[model samples]
Target: MPQMLLIVEPIGQRAERGRADGEAVYQRMLDFAAELQAEGLLLGVNSLGSAAKRLAKRDGGAQVWDGPFAEAKEMVGGYFLLDTEDEGVAMAWAERCPAAEWATVEIRGVGPCYM
Candidate 1:
């Protein structure tokens, strides 16, 4: 099984931190990823940009919206996919994530939607 750690952060939080602070925080996350990789637990990782697009179908028509969306209070800042079968191990890793210090770290199991 695989687990995903989603980094959820408030909108504009990165900007508030400014470039220097943001880079420092990002370096911490990179270090964390390196540790996970060294432990053979990291499957993949990536930081997400706030710029996004939303698509929907309405009455057989395609609708597209570009963000920053007005209704969004939070955004997914990043994700870490870990190769693990134990949920406890995943939870433990989530607890150790650098993002947990300032953002929400959401743990999720990777599987088909029907499941």
Candidate 2:
């Protein structure tokens, strides 16, 4: 099965509020994940730490930069790895994501995670 990477770019004040909300965003995500799991579309989910630790190799050499501070309004807050053949279907799933309504969810290829 082809794998689709759901780059969950969480944003907005609501997201910040969500962080403090008991279950946090998990409460919202769980429902969505359940739906996907029911359809056998979801594979895995992960939340990244503050971007502050992000390293970079910009240009042809290594150049470290400060992180945890994202310039984009929609920051890459988390990710959901889905196993699906139809990208459209995956997109449909992304549409229902709560973040998209208030923020954004970037759907991209998972690339080589094992690499």
Query: Highest TM-score among the candidates is held by which one?
Result: 1
TM-score of each candidate structure, all chains considered together: 0.97, 0.68
Question: What's the distance in Å from true for residue 88, model 1?
Answer: 0.6
What does the lDDT read for residue 106 in candidate 2?
74
For each candidate, what is the lDDT? 0.96, 0.66
- For model 1, the stretches where C-alpha displacement exceeds 4 angstroms are none
Clash pairs, model 1 backbone: none
Displacement of residue 102 (Cα, Å) in model 2 is: 1.7
Name the best candidate (by lDDT).
1
Q: What is candidate 2's lDDT per residue for 12-102, written digit by digit as tens?
A: 5444565567265657887777877888877887765544555668678876667545665555666777887677877888888865755
